[model samples]
Target: MKKKITLSILISEILNLISAPLAHAASLSDVYLPGKALGGSGATIGGFVTPLIQNLALLMTGLTFIILLLSGFKYITSHGNPKGTQQAKDMLTYSLVGLVLSIAAYWITKLAFVAAGLDFLF
Candidate 1:
């Protein structure tokens, strides 16, 4: 029963992640970093900057999730052995570092986007 419930939750989370990008994709093709967004057709420097920032955000988020999965695996394998426990602790610590670094990266990027006068993410 417990295994079934856990499996269901895991499946739901996977489905949600798969569906999110489709839901949030922007429709506009001629973006111009917010300030100069009125210009049409030609690719400007500001135009590339927006896609770069958006992709970086997705990368950071994915990296954080990967770290979390590693930590979860470590925890699961740490059952009755001292060596396993230490390994798990190490993985968890590293995971925490990755998490903090990713959050800092996200905040800094968000600040940069605002400074660049582009649309902000929450």
Candidate 2:
């Protein structure tokens, strides 16, 4: 059924988001932000900001998913009502836009660092 397909897709997306952080966790910890040299530890910007960016992406993804869920719920509860359906659709659209913007921001930040010639694995 359509509902089943939607539910499965949502689950797949949730799984993807959950696994994302784990995938890049190693790189995050290895970041060495540049700062005042401490003893023998080389002064590195606060090191790398990949963790922050990753965490932010995760947060935004979660929020977008929540929005999508809420919109779906609204659509279901509307029971053929036109205005409510429209509202739900609008929410879905906005959430998708937000997700895209978050992704863009993440990449832009990374691009900025790259443009500056800073060497850090993203």
Candidate 3:
């Protein structure tokens, strides 16, 4: 029951983070204007795709952060058990690696778009 409650809280937190950007919008039209949201001129391929890529990167980063937190929790709760401790350490390492890779990927993608002359969208 405690685990269930913790999981639910984590899920709700994630959902809230994802939706926080939209909460400030006054209308559906504001939410629909991705280009404007990103400070671009208007609707274009870059306007659409850039935000999509950014959002995906943000989501991945958030997931990695959550994984790191869980791994720490596991490590603390392992009580010196070698197997459980190892698993937690592995999870922590993997989450850090994933976070780095996702950030690099996001930068690489942005650079690619800029190279392709889509600087205005980014």
Candidate 4:
């Protein structure tokens, strides 16, 4: 009972933290600079692309975590087989590499946008 209550409280706290940013999120009108036209690429494209890249990075990171879990499970169930153990090790390495690449992609997207003179994130 104690563990359940503690776990529930922790989960709720995490949810609140995750949702806090979204709760104070900018409205569509806020996406545009005061003098910029709504339909212009500066507002529309930047707003769309920044979030899309961020979300994609987040998704890839989550999938990498799932892959890590699968790799661990495979290792545990490998039953001393050399090939299976090697496969699990390879999976773990590949998943870590993928996670790193995903994070890099997110940063690269930001840099590319800034280099293109969009500077939308700021």
Candidate 5:
């Protein structure tokens, strides 16, 4: 009974903490408005999505690089263990593939944005 009550109280506190943020949540306009947060006064889908896509691409690239490094380390440390070496090789291959895909995706998005005359967004 005591444990249950404590768990319930903890859950309630968590709910309260989460609700505080929801109560003050920004509206869609506020969120989608380009440069509003940056003290600029323009709102375009390109403006909103370009940065998001770029940032996502950058993040993915960084993560892929880190994965590649870890996988290389694993490969070097495998010490003739076939399974470990294979796993590390797989990781390296997958990370390289992901990095390539992300770069291609970023370029495609950039081309689309340019074709749409939103090149200025970049």
Candidate 6:
């Protein structure tokens, strides 16, 4: 019972610290400035960068998916032709590379921001 009470007190304090920011946000702006959400507060630059990155990410991902789907269709339609099959495989492989690179870039950027002490995006 004593241990439980102590744990509860600690947890409550943590919750208060975390939520104290909520009591002060002027807007739900982090949705826009994910990468710029530093200073422990939201800013206009962050708000803009967040949505821009999100939209570009979505666009790139969608394009990659579309490429993969089209490549699958080509491979399927190639039937038994070795040449057509090879081309389709290359397309799929290139698309995979693009996807991997995009994801890596995102992580690298996050690490860079962290190393710069720019505050981790929320």
Model 4 lDDT per residue over 66-87, tens place? 9999999999999999999999
Which of the two candidates, 1 or 4, achieves a greater lDDT against the reference?
4
| Residue range 1-122, candidate 6, lDDT tens digits | 99999999999999999978865663556555542445454355545565666676678899999999999999999997999999999999999999888878767766776676665445
Query: Which ranges in model 2 have alpha carbons more than 4 Å from their true place?
Result: 1-43, 46-48
Error of 2 at 63 (Å): 0.8
Q: What's the C-alpha lDDT at position 21 in model 5?
A: 83
Q: What value does the lDDT take at residue 25 in candidate 2?
A: 59
Worst 10 residues of 5 by lDDT: 30-39
Which scores greater on TM-score, model 1 or model 5?
5
lDDT of 3 by residue, 1-122 (tens): 99999999999999999888766754666555555765657576776788899889889988998999999999999999999999999999999999999999988988888888775354
TM-scores for all predictions:
0.49, 0.63, 0.63, 0.63, 0.63, 0.59
Candidate 4 off by > 4 Å? 1-42
lDDT of 6 at 90: 99
Model 4 per-residue lDDT at 58 = 80
lDDT for 121 in candidate 4 is: 62
Order the candidates by lDDT, highest first — what do you get?
3, 5, 4, 2, 6, 1
Write model 2 residue lDDT over 5-122, tens digit each, in one string: 9999999999999988755554433445322222235434525476767888999999999999999999999999999999999999999999999999988888888898875465
Error of 6 at 66 (Å): 0.6
